[model samples]
Target chain A: MKFTNFLQISILLLTLTFLNYFIVYQKCPAVTYDDKTVIHQLSKQNVNEKIFFITPTYSRPVQEAELTRLSHTLLLVSNLRWIIVEDSDQKTLLITQFLQRISKMKIFENFEYTHLNVETPKSFKTSRRDPNWLKPRGVWQRNEALRWLRENTTEKGIVYFGDDDNTYDLRLFEEMRNTKKVSVFPVGLVGGLMVEKPLIENGKVIGFNSIWKPKRKFPIDMSGFAINSQLIHDKHDAYFSPYVPRGYQETHLLTQLIHSINELEPKADSCTKILVWHTRTEMPKLKKI
Target chain B: MKFTNFLQISILLLTLTFLNYFIVYQKCPAVTYDDKTVIHQLSKQNVNEKIFFITPTYSRPVQEAELTRLSHTLLLVSNLRWIIVEDSDQKTLLITQFLQRISKMKIFENFEYTHLNVETPKSFKTSRRDPNWLKPRGVWQRNEALRWLRENTTEKGIVYFGDDDNTYDLRLFEEMRNTKKVSVFPVGLVGGLMVEKPLIENGKVIGFNSIWKPKRKFPIDMSGFAINSQLIHDKHDAYFSPYVPRGYQETHLLTQLIHSINELEPKADSCTKILVWHTRTEMPKLKKI
Candidate 1:
């Protein structure tokens, strides 16, 4: 009788073990979707060209806030690669970790990205007292992106210098995607004008409406233009200059890429609509006490 | 011998059960901190008054983006009660879910909030054809907040109308906290002027320097003023008027709350600093095609 009781207890224990495993399996199923699935979905269409938006970012109090805002806008576009170059001595753990988290999100999983860092030389760095307009920002970082495009990319794409703080319309990407050589559009709230636009007459680039300094051959902000990757690769030595006069970075780079003014294609309904803004966030005052 | 063997097996099974429980406990511990704990820490140090920041928010494409940015600012402040009144037919699941997630964050858990909704009547609502400036927005919602304040609280607090779209400096909160009767400060990028500030002379509110319609008794934007809660409570019937002319809501309400110009206390380094801007975000153009 004692042997019989032992057999019954063993059977009961075995039944309990199976029940527990079944419950756990029911509660915790495998995750069906992941980063690879998103990428597969995006690649299925097989688009010919993509937009490589190169944004040179740096760390500050509002760094994450600005990046978050910009990311929301960038994620809305399809067939785009985000290349974020950091102005740091090395690839910091913060940015690496940030990119890892962003890549895991549903919104960013499908988008291709390359996170790089190229530190600015001490002599080239601007001080707080210096006016922002005089600072030669994003010089080395932009060059790194250009170098990356030349080395790694053979596929058709367009390169755009998208600032972390600037506002962009989805329409701007469509214009840039259609560019054969270079494209220009109106940037609002910039250069002391309602819009620093490419003055187009009868579907040709004529002049500019930049009130701050209209005399420059290409008077525009960094957010005002885009260039085809083929053109960027063709002009091997073309890069933003660190020694240019105040507000001449756009003109200096454009002059190197384009042979004549006709190469500039005015977009956004012949440059009438303002699709981007050089909007800068005012630094917030933090009290230590 | 059989009975002895059964006892040994039973003891072994019991030991395994205890070990399993221990492993589960180790793997999944209870959350150490929560929203209630954060609120407790903030309220531990008792103060004479608190700040009641009333914000009237509506759903738009940029609603979450703007609120996230604003929450970053508002969360940094202590002793603040965020009254977010939504402009909708009913309290939305989206807003409620957003608030639940936000309130649980480490940064915002300390702040208290009330999420309320009151839809605008069809007649008073602005159409797409009407310019944003011409439409009298936030009238009924502001009054709903006022009613909530009167019905719910008896404690001494300061009330400030914080628009969701505007940029705010942390220093602005400190300035608003020091107001006795009513406080006014310079608002940046407002009324077609660099600053819409009060013209103070020898510590008196003489007049305003508003470029647009400076003739009004109190020519200021919604973000330019903060009033004592007692003054709002004392004048029980005072609320924003829906029938008021365009841009007259500020003047119409301030007229009821204050008896004389001397009652206005100028803060933020005697109103020289532009701590807040009436900054508006341009709508992004999305292609339906």
Candidate 2:
């Protein structure tokens, strides 16, 4: 009887150990890439710094071309990961296939839409109309890119949301890489008033001169600023909200970030000259495609 | 031969006359409704005195409730038409059906969401998250609503973009109806920015006091003022733009219609105490709806 009891105890212990091993394995997240391979490549020689360029494209081809040109220029400074979020469900072959061929770029395509209904009358069709400012439409896709950076990136680098239609100077990314909280630059063709920017004092941002009414906070544009990955990782709520009034998109997101606008570092000669212009692409009349 | 030619000419003239009559019958635009037939029973005897309440709604149940309450209260006012524009694609059945049940108010529902997507990143999906201050989503929607008024409204009275979330006193409408070019008032919720109104001296509007920054125009909420229909009809571009940074939605739209700050008429005892608070609704989380 003693020998039988000893055998049963041994069996029980073995089963428990097997269960613990299984649980630990389940908790471990799978790595999508070979880390040692990436590490070896990094040690061998220096490639350009990696920049995740997120561009939102709707129905404009010219804007896409302009963005592609911007991407080529960015290639000079860093590895360009152009994640193009198209406003369609099924990826169009034109944009999707074109992006896939580009070296060192990850192309993601998807679509999203939201509408107001509780106050609309029966006779009007309100939900089907495309939103004006493209409120947080591609935000989740941006978060996806952030997730990719967190998981894939070993080297420190910069991330930016480049609107498909805007003009960019090559120097902007170098300026962005130096961001502490968020670096703001002047944007033209916005605010209906004039180019908007932050009033800098002693190499620190005092406040913004935005002509449009944003809620009390860092009232700036999504494109006009850049943030460090460390800041984004540290801050819990760094994403934009759709529910913010039409113009408060940028301000509301930045408000929850680091306290003190003084923490925001100003670049591009204290944001005097325009580094970015908030230009919009007119709807193209597509013919034969 | 001469008789045959004359007969052909006569036949051609007869055909041309009949074609003219048919074209006129088909091409003349249809008047959607004769006011006398549908809501003539609800019309007040007060002919010269009329009030028009215009409101823009995005997506908030509480704001909608406020609008519904306002619609119910407007039952007291004579000859009131509530123009509600939904900033969505298709009209929501819920909102449409609700408007259908309301009496003593002609609910004209329209939708446009053009200004919501300038620099928005493709993958951001920020529109899904709820934020405070549901300001005008589309500059063109207001323009479209005003254009509709120019084409449709034959009534004489006041016009205001009573945003769905604002708190309003019925007495405020009385002060607004007498406005010549524009009227100003104090708005709450803006921290220390206090009230924005035409600075008056000797019964003249000189300039405005907006404590906000960046926007070239005075900082004001959408619910801060009212305008005479004539001014809207007379102005060239009387609408908001996404191009305007955070706080300039009100200022830009107002500046287009009025020349100097002197043109703005002050109400609520020259904006002494806030009559209307720029209150916003809090998002309610439900475990199960």
Candidate 3:
């Protein structure tokens, strides 16, 4: 009876040892990078104000190329939630996989993203023969992002339209984070001018120096400004409309949100700095191989 | 005497308190991001195999745009040291400012880098009159990068030629990191083919599926393969030659380091996956203002 009891205990000990060593070695982690622990270990103690970056991307030759470049710039930003609205009937697998790639990295796991898509109507898309300014691009796509913001988030933060093709200086993000209302800054390489920005006098925006459409109410490029996210919820009807005449998309959206130019907050050292550029990629010509 | 001593003690305590809190707060960190501490805190516990990404970039209409996109892709990858060799007489401020922006980002502060520049002689540069394939691109710039590696790096790692204009999947970086001798993988949209790769016969690479030049021993895109850093040191005299006939750049340098096909290790699941693409950005058209 003593030998029998000893044998039973020995078997149980062996079983536990096997489970602890061999079995655990075979066990795979559900999360490979341990992203949460990494963030907890490395993230800043002070919580940062989140920024919603809205980009309306399309399926052109440079689509993936443009998005890939923009993703790098945004990854540097700590508390940004990217809203990429595709101009297609359904989200392309190409972009879906691209965002997944962005999310899985351990270093920038702190970066947040949202992928949404809304097709641009055929009527709104300009043909090759049409002038570059004939039709406003990314009209409905920007609206989709705003809709996503209203339905999904109640958090108060800044919302900036970050076109994928544009060049952004990291300082621009820092300058806009403390915005209480719409913040305006200069945009480089825009509208047949070296730079375009609102005229600031005594810490107030008096008007814009946009050469193309100087008479428009809010004469600015889509990349020129950022607004408070709460204003989106307050003014539910404001959005970029395709029906608006050429060069009025900025005005059409702004008039609905603010009554006067005094509400505009001048940033980037009172709009003396050009922290972003309204640049576009030249189309590559490829004959079918 | 007692009163004097008490006053002296109070002053000492006040000075210490100010130095610890207010003075420290006002003191700017010489390195604003504390890159070293950030890396020590957030870097992977297991040291990953380092990858030396060598890119040769030149001044073009779309120079910054291409580099910006590529930088984002590299930002996600861990344990990578980018060696950017500019095709210019001196390093430009545009690229210098760009690299500074990358270094200051907290999450990717762990990234290692070296920037060098060597001007491509005017004779080697392509003009509108020349065919795309008439002149070999990035010959001297790549050699400059190789020279930099030999001078600085003694560590064993993987060396790859990452052109600024190509598209890369993050997974490709992982597949090549474990290279013992050399690794070959499929490149998409290369050589006027849907994908280009070395054809495998039974677990070994017997030949390549290159339609452009089937006879060349190592018929591959510049983005197709990576070699061990030790090989670069072992074959110290082996360098890319400008005199090598068109489309023989890969073969010229590869033949010097590797003896036969047996030395090549197939990666990305036996070269079945297309993780990189040889896509080029179309030149953007901007009429002078």
Judging by DockQ against the true structure, name the best candidate. Answer: 3
lDDT of 2: 0.54
- For every candidate, the chain B TM-score is 0.82, 0.68, 0.83
Query: If scored against the real structure, what TM-score would every candidate get?
Result: 0.50, 0.38, 0.76
Candidate order, DockQ descending: 3, 1, 2
Candidate 1 colliding pairs: none
Ranking by TM-score: 3, 1, 2
Which should have the higher DockQ, number 1 or number 3?
3
lDDT score for residue A102 of model 2: 34
- Candidate with maximal TM-score: 3
Which residue segments of model 2 deviate by more than 4 Å? A1-289, B1-49, B61-64, B104-126, B130-138, B191-198, B207-209
DockQ of each: 0.05, 0.01, 0.10
Tell me how far the alpha carbon of residue B199 in candidate 1 is from the true structure, in angstroms, after superposition.
Answer: 1.3
lDDT of 2 by residue, B1-289 (tens): 3555545645565555555545433321111122332122222233344555666666543434444444433433344566767666656775675565443122111111111212222232235454433433645556567777787766666788766545554346566767887888876544344344446677665565654562366556677778888877787457667566666777788888876676778887766655565544334322221
Per-residue CA lDDT of model 3 for B182-280, tens digit only, reads 899998777767778998977789899888877898998899999889999999998998898999999999999998887889998989988787777
Docking model 2 quality class: incorrect
Per-residue lDDT tens digits for candidate 3, residues A1-289, read 2555545645555455555444333221111222332223223322266789999888876676567667767765667899999989999999998897665442333567899999889888888778767888988989999999999999878899999878787667777877877889998767766678889999999998877878888998898989988899999989888788988998899999998888999998889987787766655444365
Give the per-residue Cα lDDT of candidate 1 at B263: 81
